[model samples]
Target chain A: MDQRKDDANWSPPRQHLEIGDSPADFNTGRVQGRRLTGPQQGFGQLWQKTYKVAIPNRTPEQIIATWKAEYGRFWPSNSRFYAPVTGIKPGEVGLIKSNQGPVPLSTGVLVLYSDDTSFSYMTPEGHPFAGFITFSAYEDEAAGTIAQVQLLIRTNDPLYEAGMIAFGSRAENKMWEHTLRSLADYLGSSAPVDTSIVRVDRKRLWKNFRNIRYNGALPWVRKVRSS
Target chain B: MPESRIAMSVRAPKDTVRVIDIAGELTAFGEGVLTEAYEDADRPGVKSVLLNFEKLDYMNSGGIGLLVTTLIRAQRKGQSLGAYGLSDHYREIFSLTRLDEAIGIYDDEASALATT
Candidate 1:
């Protein structure tokens, strides 16, 4: 499939998110009707993080195919991703129930792009980070085939920004590292995962402080506290 | 399969504006050239860095990510970023990614330059 064709692999423009036939048992409603946000719209300092692991026997296409099919299974134990019935195609919305602090954070991601060797997710307005997370597999000169995840993101709001600066960043890093390790293990490789983080911008967008109003975890935390 | 390649050349249309004429597929493979081109166009006294996408043939999600990074770099330097010559499809891409909010998009180079 040529990526340049009109509406080829890119998700169509959407005004609000809409969930498809996902599991009914999972908690929902935080993502529906929310607008998608990119790193440019986020509040905190921009950062680009990359995590990679080499899988010796698998081809890049084979790795991506498995990753897309078993996307949720590779996540850490605390996270649950409910992919749509149509799988990880462009424009598909996937619901997520993940832990943020002690409370459950219910949000979702839009499949922004997908190809044979790579796929990307864009977060909704209230996701912890506003940006794109791309999972790809490529053939490297030194390593036969490398599976990688790269994120270009910033915290969605001031509170999330503070949380990220405090401890959330470390947890996020560990989560991805665990994911890569799991993927490598699943693919029958013991290669060590390599990680890199770069701060793309130092300044925060103070204007987006109001985004805290849509924080998904805060309401749950407050409700638990008040009860 | 042929390798994807992208090239960017900096042109100073005026003292305050530098335009980057981009060609080829703007993917992760083009990061080095894009960064170098951006730095070259981001010389002192240049307040606006506009991208020319007339010759751009293909772009993937990685390309969109690169654009966002470019936008951040421009914002950090206090320079405005704009783009022109995008096909309707690519323009829609900019909208989908919400990049249209931060970077000005124009139909042609003349219109983009006229604004600056």
Candidate 2:
């Protein structure tokens, strides 16, 4: 059967991420069975960030194809994205190893949706931000093909919220900027990335303060200090 | 291809639950319609709001986020919410995202509407 015809770009369902019996890596098995967390479930104020680059001669489909194929390659080098064995199709889990200032963090994301022109990922429990980041491309009559990444996120816990206020925000901004710049460079352009941030909600959800229990930094701190 | 358009209508069915009927695709750009519909339905004395996905054919992950956001807001406002008419695919999506744990999922309209 042609899965594309039946599913129409949507992902199938899985109760939990089945990490199976893979050899131990940094944090592959941690997020294996954890549930996905969205921005609303987080404790901090909500934010929507957009990073975009204008691709002069490319079509939206072309840009999206390249973005999906080389998604991990466009990262900022220091971070690692382990694409799932089945690739970035919807419902697959991708492991991530990144840092916040001097702290090494490990987490993963679920490929929630994937289509020709766009794909979105949902962060798992214990991730710094409970959120969704969408990568997409579209034809803008004025700007040709617009390759963009949009993030709607909220700090997953009080500790992560404090980190964001310190240096995490800047580090995150640079990371995505680097990604967009790399994508533009990959497509044979050097256009400066455009970034915009919006505070979608100013009030924090104090009710979610307990989310600190899943903070990845605690385990990371313990692991690093012991070694 | 034509851009997807989202349309929503809110009406009380059986003089009980307020049903919000959603149609067309739920994408990032189409979120405003869902928001507006929820706003209109979330009035004083409305005990529960049921989202009718019968006419909703396509919804991406962003749309699921939008639904989750709306559910959070509605619950915060003390208005209980439920949904019906999701195909098995979407039902699984809800399960995968753990949205099934957050929102009540029903098989069809009759069973959903028949409930309190």
Candidate 3:
């Protein structure tokens, strides 16, 4: 077997993320010791949300290059993604600061794979969703060049599921829609972003109800511990 | 660097399980075809799905994410999921993502088909 194939396509095995020093405010031990969580480990029904925008006349490679460099700048205003100084690359961790209420929720994602046309991030424990998000650009026969963000996720815990049922899903859709719109604007296209959502699973994994213990905000610590 | 493509075919050699064989590399480009095949394979009275990855030479992160979503879709339809013929490396990939815990990983089609 050619080992280079695996080396080129997969992130090196790591139990936990090692976040380097950066000017980012949210990276202070927030991601340390947190196990990476996939959708199977989450408590809510699974969802796959795909957001795409067509940026005509540009090659997929060029779009990906710009997307990687300007990743944080394309996010919605309410959430701030603090990319590492070295920028998005395989095996790096990026901190994300978002608000649930008065408390700021600090979480991070591991750069699980990076290549010329695509990169993916795996969430750490306590993130709103447990899963991997892949960002990529590809050429569609009719669309010319399409930049897409696909999220395969489930709410991380019972509390998170409750929150999602109340508001998180809409907020998440709007957030990514804003992001695709921003990316389209950056790429000089006024095309409306396309959003497709699929409810991948309707059954909740009750076993992961205990994941609330890892809640990353001050507001949830006592609430989770008491119950 | 061979061009990536996943040729999928679904069959039912047993009453309760549907076996989907996926060959070639699975990446961003391979998802739509797989999704279509998965949806087409859905049938009443099938209690489980056995994904045969024996001919799959490569799977990137996008492919892994696609698999997770596929698993979720299967679960939603009340079908148990299992996989067979994953290379050792891909098996590790499943373990790292804890997807192996969600679905059984088997050594062969017969074993996976026999799974209860």
Candidate 4:
């Protein structure tokens, strides 16, 4: 078999997530030692979502470079991505403290792959969604540079699936739309973002229904109830 | 670096199994080809679909996502999906992404065909 050097762009095999040096302000407990989960491991219906915006002047490489350098700055105000000290490279873990409805959900993602034009994140256990989200920039003949965020996700558990059906799905769409708009605005573009969402699979994995035990919002909600 | 476009061909070596010989890079660009090849291989009375990745040069996260989608497609059709000829690097990738749980990995064509 021929071995290509592109292997370096992928993260090394890991049994569980490990958070390295990150800021003290970030909540890092939920991700440490938790196993990574993909769409197959999730409990809800599978979804593929894509959001893209055209940037007039930048190249794919330039757009990707800026996207990597300022990854969290493009998020909606309610979401906070705490990038690791090593930046958005392969094998690094990043913490996320974002709001899901009224719940302040804390979770993290593993940087699964990274290169000049693209990077992808795989969610750890207990995240609202289990899947991969890829950010990429590509050159288009007519549109010039296009920056895109594509997600293949399923809700992590029954509770999250209920939340997703209630309001989380719409909020998730708005979140990415806001992120793409923020990125485009920062890169000197006001182009309208294009969004496409597809339900890839309608069946839910009943086996993974137990994943609700690790839901990050549970502890927070319990704390509030006692307070 | 030269551009590497994905190429795929389907063949049924036996009544129960169909093999997709995939070559070149497997990325988003290969989606349509992969889908077409998979459809061709998933004919009636075929119980298993095996992917022959000996000629696969490179694969990214997008390619991995494609595989997941393929697995979903196979499941929906009540057919099993397996793969062989993956390099050590990609084998590890399969483990990391936990795709190995759903798709069987074999060392060669004979081993994959013998089981399925």
Candidate 5:
């Protein structure tokens, strides 16, 4: 859409996930938007739904297969991987087996992978894309294997900062968070991998952004604009 | 101290340049910088802009918007703009956002200065 028109309506989402160290019923003040200050001095543990994704169903093989087939389409080619095998036999036989592609791209904007690892990447312009951390389950000598994927996201829309974050007002942060949560909900527990968002230290994240350090924990973060 | 800081540095080459050290999580800060920078630039037609992203670690979609806005503005004013350093993950973000299609990126201080 046009710039002004896009910016005119729709503020950031302000919904909050059930995160807080309180009695599960404590308000903890406003959940979405900025001013998400916490544990409220003694609010217990202050938590935001930074990453709480419910992975979809299916198997790891199936999920990886789908990603290899089309996940690259939504993103650039850099997000893909390949596994190849080549060997020489005893006397005069040679065998070569190799597979390469995206690890089963999700049916939504979220990215997916089957390996027991995660990655990080950025836009050439500096915008961070939603990256993810992966967890894998293997059964019986590798015959049965399962995979879980998680994504970390933040709202990109400018209207929901709500004065919580320094950039866009809380309103923008609120809307963006809501949109992302909605996207996460839509992806649900239908795919082979489970995805979630986790809040990392912002300062640490910045350090990581500059290539000076990495937390080695959180995977990816993204900006979501309301459609 | 709101967020962890990165290692990239945006320094002044001639001491005549004015820089803005933006802090906060970029997911939302991107919009804030765009709004304020556009309003503050020398009334359209000024050159030589440097964004000290040393404090920015993670930039979401809003961060992309903020950079895009800055790039476009600079292009209009015949300015030289270059982002010197970014976290390894942010590099992928550049590719994801396709900012390479719009502006230029440098690896460190000297290159950013030389390009401009």
Candidate 6:
């Protein structure tokens, strides 16, 4: 009772949003994104995390033809294209770009796997790249501008998995210093890469999501591999 | 760390050339290995340079960018740049970044040198 009275006198932190001030931007998604995996679906419908691939200033149209023409020949065995992506329908590959908040995938080969086995092949380093942002929309739901992009990769991104398991642990240091720098550059982080070795684990990834998820700015993150 | 490292081989007039390989993760020192190999080019008049990556694992973006920078410098001095022995993953990064498109890449060092 005494603690409750003390709490009433104090104001909430400015950085943290209260329930009333919460913006309509937070979202949670799984692999394949909110995209429909098949043509038919109902209450039991399955959705996959979808991402839009974009490169700063490199328009999709200009690079699409050359991408398919040059590297299309190297698509994986089960995959129609080496760069697995999703949009449109099967047997089609093109550069997709939408300014709308509905997706994050832009200009890579959209892969449609017969089974989910592709996850095993995806390297941890192959986390989605390009400049696209993410957002969510569903039946009877209003879409809002996003501050973070939470997602799940369908493939087994080894480093991503290990990094999570080894979060705050020794594996963080095993990475090249340049990776941190590259991410810093990618995220426009002012902090230098290798600022300090992180010591964390599964508990850390879930508990302290605020810091790990885009340094408390953009919530865009692929939370886990399995989820 | 990848269990294996890329092997180095030379195929110019065998008597006139030496090669040092940069394979697996291109660490800070990996960059040095590459620079030294070229700087310490044994034969002053060596006509070709081979960056053999066979059994190679991966090259970080810095390494990729380094390759690009090196390609330009090598060409300026009339030396041909050859990159071979890329794994599927590295090959993807190279192709996606258009590094493969920008530079000449062969499947093997022998092919690279023989052509030169």
Model 1 stretches with alpha carbons more than 4 Å out: A1-6, A220-227, B1-4
Q: Which parts of model 3 are misplaced by more than 4 Å? A: A1-6, A22-24, A218-227, B1-4, B39-45, B110-116
Off by over 4 Å in 6: A1-227, B1-18, B27-29
Top-down DockQ ranking:
1, 4, 3, 2, 5, 6
Candidate that would win on lDDT? 4
Best by DockQ: 1
10 residues in a row with least lDDT, candidate 4 chain A: A1-10
Each model's DockQ score: 0.59, 0.34, 0.40, 0.55, 0.02, 0.01
Residue pairs that clash (backbone atoms under 3 angstroms), model 3: none
Docking class of 1: medium
Residue A165 displacement in candidate 3 (angstroms): 2.9
Regarding lDDT, does 3 or 5 come out ahead? 3
Docking class of 6: incorrect
Share of real contacts kept by model 4?
0.60
- Model 3, residue B16: distance off in Å is 3.6
Interface RMSD of 6: 24.1
Instruction: Report the lDDT of model 4 for residue A139.
Output: 79
CA lDDT, every prediction? 0.88, 0.79, 0.82, 0.91, 0.32, 0.33
- Per-residue lDDT tens digits for candidate 5, residues B21-67, read 55545532245445565445434334566665555645544345446
Model 1 agreement with the true structure over B10-106: per-residue lDDT tens digits? 9999999999999888887688889999999988999999999999988888899899889888988899999999998889889988999999999
TM-score winner between 2 and 4, please give it: 4
Q: In candidate 2, what are the lDDT values of residues A21-105, reduced to their tens digit?
A: 3436666645878767777678888888889998879887888889888889999878988887777888777888875467777
- Stretches of candidate 5 off by over 4 Å are A1-227, B1-18, B41-45
Candidate 5, A109-132: lDDT as tens digits:
112111212211110111122222
Q: Which candidate model has the greater lDDT, 1 or 3?
A: 1
Q: What is the TM-score of chain A alone in each candidate?
A: 0.93, 0.90, 0.91, 0.94, 0.26, 0.19
